[model samples]
Target chain A: MKLVAVTSCPTGIAHTYMAAEALSEAAKAAGHELEVETQGSAGLDRLDPATIAAADAVIFAADVEVRERDRFDGKPTVVAKVKDGINRPAELIERAVAAAAEAPAASTPAAAVPAAGVSPATKAEEGASWAGRLRGWLMTGVSYMIPFVAAGGILIALAFLIGGPEIASKVNGGTFDGHTYKGVSDLTLILNQFGVAGVMFKIGATSFSMLVPILAGFIAYAMADRPGLVPGVVAGLLASAVGAGFLGGLIGGLLAGAIVLQLVRLDVPRAIAGVMPVVIIPLVSTLVVGFVMLVVVGKPIASATNGMTGWLNGLGDSNKILLGLIVGAMMAFDLGGPVNKVAYTFGLASLSAGNLNIMAAVMAAGMTPPIALALATVVRPKLFNDAERKAGEAAWLLGASFITEGAIPFAAADPVRVIPSMMAGSAVTGALSMAFDATSRAPHGGIWVVGLIGHPLLYLVAILAGIGVSAASVVALKSRRILVPSGDAVAAAAPSSRGVVAA
Target chain B: MSQIITPDLVDLDLPGTDRVAATRALAERLVAAGRVTDLDGFLADVAAREAQMPTGLEGGIGIPHARSAHVSEPSLAFGRCAAGVDFGAEDGPAHLVFLIAAPDGEGAEHMKILASLARRLIHASFKDGLNQAADPAAAATFITQEIAA
Candidate 1:
């Protein structure tokens, strides 16, 4: 069905564009032809009168009065908040289609007003920005979750430093050293070595537990603001409760936030406006997201995590090198991105499973990108920009400290060149680390935790080898001056094309 | 010829978590920039606009805007808070805040700048550009470039 939408927010600013983008995208995705008119601060980009006449249904997704509502008086109509344009485009389209079906087209040819508006030249070019926007939205959540990952991972590593690897394995809760703990909880904790280390381990694990929920909560916050938080958080906890991991958290966060954004778009009566934010929005979003997550999304991701666990365990001794290579590639693929986190989390999972090689590879590869980029900049300073040179200086400390995100500036600047090189280097390090049977009990603290690593010297050697490879590759790429489109470099960290990345 | 957002108007380390204080801080920058004739009077106008409805947008942003006689020119002041300040957003606090002060009367420059800004805000890259600015100068430059001034 053909649909026409008018999107306007109270401020007639950002929300207007966001809603227009959402509705058009959703409509297109659902196989419906859609056009949107944005009455924003930029003035009206009116829908063509001919186009509106052809539209079978009209969606008035406006917070303020539609400038030309009288034009669509006779058409099948769906009145909604502008928020829904972005968050509930498909639903709105469905309603419009249904409304069109219900209202007989030939029954009443209402007196036609004169064709008043021209076709807009501002039909936003969506192109590659769609993927970039989704990435931005997801990263919004991940960015917030990182502090939890760092502090929690380090604390757990610290616990290992003090109490040894047994604490983590013990806390993982299963058959261990003949003592079997049935579950993982405060109540289930069996502290045979109830020392300072054990207490630290518990504290660290507790902090780590909040990552998914925080990730989910903030993602919602990004998508829909204050109303999105309540639902996003609840759904995140649910994701964990159902064993869906960060993937589930990502989906649930998106779902909860979108639902809340859509709900807020509802034009509630003045009498109920007070209760809308506090009671109605949260209640409705939570209920809808809860049902969707538990029933629809929860199962698939649960199986995925469970399957990944089994696959990692099944890798055993024979496929250790292969496992290392795979995880290493993942670590460098985005350098602390979703793929990297998946590998890191996988390694963390294996730690509790009493397998340490995965963790060893994870660390080696995670440290490779920054160190390699830093090395590249130093080896061939002319190849790098001034900013790259500066970042290189800081990369040394960040890489040594095991902060993978230090390479973000470099990777973001020249992703096509930087990422593959880093991945290749990390993969080599990972495979070599596994080949040498390197293992780590600690989750973080790069050079500082060398004492905690099994075969420390070999591990360092593996990191060095990866660093050399990456530096060589990046420097070589730079020297060739095979310049990527300047636009792509900025696309690494954000939407280089503004007013449209989100649009 | 004068830019709407200047280096001095960009505060990288805006302190505290109170929106009122944050607004006042940004307003003070405008006063210092000589864009506003009166501080209290301008803030009062901003507060009144905010009272009608908050200027906060999703994705960690708060835009407190107003048209006032106290504002001598159309000016924008950017402030970022590491420790976010509550802007009455449902999600929590706002980390990035843009204070837009427009001169009273019939000038459309402020509206045009605002519309350009509103359009730009929808893009994550623009926000990222603002976020990653090393200093106020870099931020001011970026805003000018993106707003195409």
Candidate 2:
């Protein structure tokens, strides 16, 4: 017997390929010639029209909607879940073969056979996988969030550039001449007002703020496959409502995903499959996740966030330097991963609450690593390879403009040494800025872009000092040769294409 | 079944021909080989079906086919080209061509054959082997062995 099959999963990942492999192996064992095509993240592969022409039967093992079904107008096709392809591939194949064999000889003309559109239930079931649904939601949400982060960060930068010291005194609770303070204070007020433009902005920002939860929700959806989306969204919303924030959202997503997987095993009718994703799973999972967030998870996280904020506000005098060091290290440690984002978020929240010094320390530490690393590669060329030297030139511009991603290539190439070195440099800069009572009215931008920094000259001095130390340390520590040789260098060093190298 | 398989039905440069041209060329070959009675009717059948939707299969392959009133019997033409031709695929370029010809009233056998071929072509090694076969005889031998297994 000969058979043809198509395999696909919602997330476009593991299960699709696994099912294809299982079916191929089973057919081979059964003395049947089998050909299986996988629809994955990278797209389709290995398609031959001749094989399709000769197959005795067709099988579709999928969680997502399969396109181009009209091509199989006359063939008997067995549509089953990818799981069936994995656990009972031979059985599925045999059934398809039997059906094809038993069908009456076509009395009707082939050209007259009607093309079949996919059933609505099948369409719904195809998209029911939690991952597919959540991803659709997250893609929508992330598209909305980018504007908030950019606008908020830039407006704050502009306020400082125009108003400067007088506004700083007002936010710090120092009494300036009311008239002078009012001039600066008015601009801050105007900027703050845009933070809530209208009901639409409010809703959009609220959705955007739930970004992490959305990511978690989609990941869970991917795992549980269909019937996971509803629960995942419910869990995400619950996490948001209860202040479990992103962590709660992650838990909710996972919980929803697991529950849906269990539900799918019940072998419900194909008609109900579509409804399970949009209505049933969400309703059940939301109730469970929401209850947990409200009763068990919400209070502790809210209290912890408050307690941390209070401690941060009270950090003064003798403890100021220590606080700065910690904040600085946290900001640079992950370079924009969760820990770094958390530190940056804290600084922005503090700015909203009128605490400018913490933001100052953050800005100082955030800009140090890239600037220092860029300087290091320039001052000591032998410490890096040719690629690093070229990358250093670009990093210099990004570093000077205060884009922390400037150091990413270096860190990615050698995280062990580069990351630790950056953390140390940033921490020292932050601690020193705090100790010197450095202040910034704005959130970010490099030292040379003084409009964004308070006490611009002092900030420049501190930045330069940090860069000097980091560059010297890198020169001392980094090896005198490139770690990974350049492609050109490797080619040049090769004996010859015609000659083989002895092991 | 007075079907005929001709040399033109098995070409070396088909992987590079335009899909419409290739299909016409295939139909012409079948007509010349006396596999089908009316060439114009066969071409019309294929064009009408193609107008509804393309038959470009996934995995860098395509099956451009038509069942026509002109066709006297069901027949297949296999073509291979050193340089793959563009068949307006969603992912771009198609290298393998299988032009299927059947009587307008033929049964499910045509669909079954197309499905079987589509499934086997998913194996990268098999497609590569077929593409590299030295001649039409070698290609036919390989296909026979694959189906018989």
Candidate 3:
């Protein structure tokens, strides 16, 4: 059978490709041709109508909903969890083949039946429940906001590197009447006069200024599509103007998305309805969001933001260590999954509030997992294959750059052993960093920002210690055990000896 | 769609030591019934899929299927192994096995039957009905009727 399949996951990273690969391999083994389109972090690999027309069946192996699934209505279909596709592709394919044979001819091909465990409504509702849907919107916003954050942060880091920490104040306080310097040294005077690094700093600051609005805009866009963008951005700007931070951006995004979605659903005459999405809806929604943010909610949100930051700033040493441990474990938990995102976002919010230590601990912990895995591969070569060893070599660079996603392959392959090992290391690092009172001024630069880090030697010690623990533990655990999918669940039920019945 | 399986395609009790032997045994039955034109070609396709991933699911079921040029029509072969065949599932070996085969160029029709069979297989009652079937005819009737419904 000629088959077409789509694979996606909430994070749109490793699992998406793994499921796609599994499906294709199964299809080939079955002597059937298959094409798999992956909707992943990188973007979409679209399946054309020609492929759909020729397909005997369609398989949607996704945790997230398969976009444009209606296109497959004329084909026999099987929808299963992405993990199930990885585990039971042959069965899924057989089911699809059977459905194809039973479905009537193309004259009335509309009766394509859903396989077991999937209904059309449920498929659409994959992440449609209130909280899940909200999470999806936030993730969309985060994904879109990442580039701006990276660019702005790296530029600011560079500015600090070249012009020193005093640059921000110096650029404002120091003065030069075109030729004469006042209140600064020669280099500082000249540098401050020309504002050479200052330009880069200002541009970066400008980009940082856009972060909240962009996050808000994209979150709303994810919820109501393009119609929500204008109001969301405007509301975010209002929040920023009123001294509201990430929390305000989040609320503004939600409010704008809701308002715009409601507006989109409003009944109107044909000509006016046609114009509404392009003009009327955006205009009305933006005004509404602006009023809500500036007039009603601004002061309350600003005070809440201040209170949150103040409380974080006032945390005692023990509380700080506990907070760091929790954040660190979350960062390593899924290796850039939603839990990791929550911790990282919290760190960013803290950075905006001038608490550099939280960001420092978060980044250090985030960087530990992949680095530890890479170290483990070197320390115990027998535990990993040739391919994995090669991957470890690349992981060194990814870890140094603080891309937590570098550990995903290892975690995906052996979550049972790798994740806990990673979490252990990260928690140690986070807690130790906090205990040592290490702080980092730069939002990100990985090891390159070691110069900007407070208690640099102890910070390095904390990181190395974490690497040692994670590397040793992961190697030990993996050697003693096999990586069963959802192995933890199996382990919890070991006494019962009823694996199949648990599900 | 036409009946994809018959008594000729059913084996109430198949004795095979492993997945390969079981798969080949089922494919041979299809060949013997004139449903398959090239036995080697068809078996090769089935073996290729088994090598890719073990078809053993969580249950005691192994579904090994192929779409091959050797197949004359879309067909299903059922085998109940009293002695289990190891299909390399995480849980264990498989006792109830299904071999789905389809001829080349009949993709749509093949998938329709395959999907219906898959949907019915999810129910424990449906599996129990197949397990308790008296003979090949009874098993075939049970499978065909259940899928049709």
Candidate 4:
């Protein structure tokens, strides 16, 4: 017998697809033709009306309520929890079929059965659950957001490269006058005039800036399934437009998803299902979530974000020493994970605001851990395992290029000691460079690439000092082990278990 | 006389073996129990199916089952081993065995049975119950209830 199945989960991450997979495999094994519609983070992946019509039975394995149940008024329908779909789908289907067959024919009146239309099935299939739909919408936003960071960074780099050094010159000891830099001033004019590119870049950046809201929306979609998508997207858009950025988006997405799901469970007529996705759901969700974000949540969140950004940007001059320590510690804390990204993003933003000093400090702190670790391993092989020693050799180049991720392997292996040591060394470097009034033009790379930096020689000196401190600390910790031959040490320190071992 | 059992029946003892060698050994045991007819044929059938795709299902379980003409009748020979068998899964290993034996002619009914078994396995508690089942009869009874429910 042909069967139609719908699978969804609360998180819409793993369980949704897992249930679908189980059902498909079981059906294949049982010699029955089956079609499964998955309501997941990506939205309604597979929804074929013909399959539903042809099926001898229908199974709904979901945590969230499904929309357009009226379509299956006369058909055999089995609604079970997602867990049941995973653990007992065959049993559930058989039971559903039996239940449908045994039910009185009078229970579903012929007049009550709505004509099978695309809207009801479409709404049922796509808007069946709010969480899954929300996830899909939010992911769509995130996928579009990444290009902004890349484009903005590259354009700003070009602007700085063409402009003369004086373009970076401070005005009245506070503001920066781009007019002073002749080459860059001309280039900036031309770039600013490329209205289309500027608009595209702005939109991308603005969209990218709304990452938090999008994430929230997707999370909700994953929970609520198809019906959740409409509310989730609406909530995310509202969050972005109202200045909530990340926090507001998350709240809005969740609110929208929950509201839509509640409405779907009300079991409105089949005729209304078609209009729900495009009109009724979006209108209600936006009106509710938009009002909440704008009047209630928007102001506080905007103030908080602005306050945070201001606090971060103000970490210069007076508190240069403390700021350096914090930046340095954060960079080495997760190597290149969220903490490091936050610090790096803050420093990069500073470049646009004409405060290159923080960037200089950040660049110095960023390279310290990997460079220091590499040098430490080279000077004293006893401090690291054979695998780490070999990794250190490659890390030297990464350090020189200011790729902080190079130290991840070493940190992952021994986070406790390595992370603290790297943070201490980095913090020291950041503090010293900031105190010396060092400035950088670029967001990344070592002192070697900081030729355009103010006081380039000082930057190099600070980097050297940080590297020395890191190496010394590591050596002090590792001096107990005897230094083995370089070749043997390299063989012993293979990075992965799959690495070929040499005699 | 050494009985030649097909690979179709041997592949059923998946959850009963942790390695290829163990799986082969379980296949031999099933042959001794008269649950499988031709050992080579059963193994060949399993190898062929595995080459196409793995039988690893969701919920940390795997079902390595096959059908062949060598089998005289439809049967289920289950084996529960101490260690989890590595069935070349993307995530890990196989922990449950439900070897289904059907004649090559048993077409759609075989698929229906597989589907029913798969649907029941989607439940976490059901899987746990299967793993904790005291013996083969208990496991079979649990499975039968799951299919019926």
Pick the winner on TM-score between candidates 2 and 4: 2
lDDT of 1 by residue, A198-301 (tens): 77778767876787788788778656655777899988888777766565677789898778867766777989987887789889999999888788876775
CA displacement after TM-score superposition, residue A293 of candidate 2 (Å): 3.6
fnat, candidate 4?
0.06
Per-candidate interface DockQ score: 0.12, 0.04, 0.03, 0.04
Quote the positional error of residue B80 for candidate 3 in Å.
72
**Cα TM-score per model:** 0.42, 0.40, 0.37, 0.37
Q: What order do candidates take by lDDT, descending?
A: 1, 3, 2, 4
Give the fraction of reference interface contacts each candidate recovers: 0.17, 0.00, 0.02, 0.06
Residue B96 CA error for candidate 3 (Å)? 67
> What is the clash count of model 2?
29
Strongest candidate by DockQ: 1
Task: Output the worst ten-in-a-row residue range by lDDT, candidate 1 chain B.
Answer: B106-115
Candidate 2 iRMSD, 1 decimal = 12.0
Candidate 4 chain A least-lDDT 10 residues = A494-503
Candidate with best TM-score: 1
Better of 1 and 4 by TM-score: 1
TM-score of chain A of each: 0.50, 0.45, 0.44, 0.43
Q: Which stretches of candidate 3 lie over 4 Å from their true place?
A: A1-136, A169-195, A269-275, A305-431, A437-455, A463-503, B1-149
